[model samples]
Target: MDNLSNYFGQNINQKRIVVTGGTTGIGKAIAKLLVSLGGRVFVFGRDENDLNGALEVIKAKSFSGEILGISADITQKDDIDLIWNKVDNAFGGIDILVNNAALPARGIIEGNYEDWKYILETNVLGYIAFAKEAVNRMKVQKSGHIINIGSMSAEVKEKTGVIYVSTKTAIRGFSTALRKEINPLGIKVSHIEPGAVTSDMQEDSKEVQKEKIVSMEMLEAEDIAMSVLFCLSQPKRCDVVSMQIRPHLQII
Candidate 1:
């Protein structure tokens, strides 16, 4: 894809955006891409060090848009407030909200309860809190776009464990319901499912490569980031709704 042109050809610039877990992996890629396209990006993450490192990268890129890093744990209410308050005060309001933080579950039914709790809090509850807040903020402004980063595992239930599968499925439904309710308010909601991306979330395993079921290209974080930019570029009247992205090599 060609480089994204700025909002008004005034360098890469757009309205303010808030992205959770924007310090690393897919979230980081999305943040970088958005900044590249001239959008001010406010990133919230739990680790200050990681956030600073990410900040360095964005600075190195010399992104025309501003990038703010707020260290906040999404699971904690106080942290959430601090980040959102900063965002609200800085931008007045956000034009886009991307919920991309999540815990990866990779065990069988016999996995420990800790795994389940951690995943649920991060993947399900955290997303809900962020979504609720985003809705409230957007409602006041009378417009906004929300893009939730889901997973392909939501559709192929049998492939993943209980916690991961359940949260993804629930989020898909959440997006649909939220969209239905907010469409009248002109707040667009969308869920994007990405498959087989090379990121820290799947760093522990080479399972997909070992399987060797297909020879097509594996997805890159940039690909997912580009998809996000596409959704944002759409006219307010047209919502992309839901997008499921998978590597051509993988059938499941």
Candidate 2:
């Protein structure tokens, strides 16, 4: 068999990946799935305890590949630098970056400047900073992928949580422009927008969330994780620019 066809899907085996806010919820789920598929994964969160716990669980289930964890705030430049330094030493170079760290926003009228500032820094600027770092290395390799976890709230534009909505809208625009700017470098950018996922960010209780999931009124964090894997597994010629995933029964 001397076939020389170049058409093939991206294999996750041995791929170096960085996942932010990976101590819990969707980020953790994504990290777990990636590691299971044989991708070397580095995950970080703001809480030391959470990071440790997530690493424990992820490592236990990982049949192949490697996993590491660190506790650091994504909005801090020093923290990001520290993470990247460790990544360089551990993985040599990155093949993928998942920007997922974020804080839930209060109502527009509820918080003052400091509150809004914190959310903006974590949700908006943090993504940009991480992307910049990833691009620095990815451009040199001339191939990589950046997956941004967004929310459907950007388009839903509900009356409440205007701050969160605004940040998501900015992410939508940023992802579009980022793709255009970096696509020429052979790096792929994908924005995944999810709706009504049951996570720590939600106000609903565990029982309520479970019921909602049963009723298809909400999605599970793992659902979004699967979407991420789908995007990454595509062939290089096929770039999944953006994806919107919602529960079948969820409306809003």
Candidate 3:
């Protein structure tokens, strides 16, 4: 895709952006692209090493906007509070929030109750809590955008992927209802559902993922990042509410 900030003649310079799960995969790509487009971004992640890695890359990039990394687990309320406190001190206020933190899950047939709880806490509860924070702040500001990263499994509903699929489906509903409730308040909410992306979240081994990538059976992280930028670049009068992006060859 073309340079997003310049593509539609949009001016996002200095825009304060908060991205969850931004130390890897699709979130990292979004952070990199946002910085390249001159948007000040604060990316949150649970791992210190990954946060440092992402920060290094962001700093290495030559762009007008800068990036910061925060070490915090999205599932923790204390961490969430600290994230916002840091954001307030660093950016004064937020203009955009991207809820992208999620964990992959597999079959419930084995009764992996622990894994299921963790996934729900991270994917479902985490998103809702963080979004509630952004909505409260955005409501006061009277203008803001919250973008939720969902998955195509929300609709596809694969048998073995019940836990992961259920969370994405919940996100779809949350996005739609939140948009209706907040649109009149001047806040925009959107959901981006992607199909078969090559990421660490995949259940397959790295070797298999590599094969899929080589065969062009999956979408790159940057592809989803561009779609995010596309939604952000739209005119104020337009809201690209729900977008489902997939590689052309992806069967789903």
Candidate 4:
């Protein structure tokens, strides 16, 4: 008999996915990859211009699956609710939730409290809030996948900035506990940690250093996309809890 699962194909093709911060950087890259693989993706962000620009890029990539643009800050519950409501009404339930939204880097002791708060709220709260909502929906459907974008900084502490590292570390813990809580219920939670990818967030003064990493080699956004795809593409009977990506040049 034909069913909702059948439509999604063997590896979650028709599955509905929500990608936060899906306008640029890693998020945009992931959204594009997922759509190309036949999964429907709804991108959420705060800037209309950036969102529309990303929409154009994704469209130009020839994504036949549903591509939606939602202009809403992940920090706000109302905005999150609106996006989820649209997804629920349109796709009934989400099969994948990629919490890829994160605030730009900021200093630890030198940075303002506001900056720190923003990072925590968006990087941590935003991901958790969406996961909470997605879990509720998935609970009813009896299955779902939650993939959080983590940083290598989570494991390697650096003098560069502690705020970002702290929150990412929290995510590592969160993903583990969240998985244990929901695994029995059939939901899968995975964390993807990438080391030093070329992104807008890379420091300008350290461009040469980033270039070395990019050259001697850091993982491309698509590499991370593939890592994420691997976690999602696992057989329904299998579960991959966590995996980290490190370039050959990277020591830690």
Among these predictions, the greatest TM-score belongs to 2
Clashing pairs in 1: 12-38, 13-38
- RMSD versus native structure for model 2: 2.9
Can you tell me which runs of candidate 3 are displaced by over 4 Å? Answer: 1-11, 205-207
Candidate 1 structure quality by residue, lDDT tens digits, 66-122: 899878888787888888889889988788899999977864656788778778888
Q: Cα miss at 111, model 2 (Å)?
A: 0.8
lDDT of 2 by residue, 23-52 (tens): 999999999988887889999999899999
Ranking by TM-score: 2, 3, 4, 1
What overall lDDT goes with each candidate model? 0.83, 0.91, 0.87, 0.84
Task: Give the winner by TM-score: 1 or 4.
Answer: 4
As for lDDT, the candidate ahead, 3 or 4, is: 3
Better of 1 and 3 by lDDT: 3
Task: Estimate the TM-score for candidate 3.
Answer: 0.94
Instruction: Report the C-alpha displacement of residue 20, candidate 1, in angstroms.
Output: 0.7
| Root-mean-square deviation of every model | 3.3, 2.9, 2.2, 3.8
Q: List the residue pairs that clash in candidate 3.
A: none
TM-score of 2: 0.95
TM-score comparison, 3 vs 4, better candidate: 3
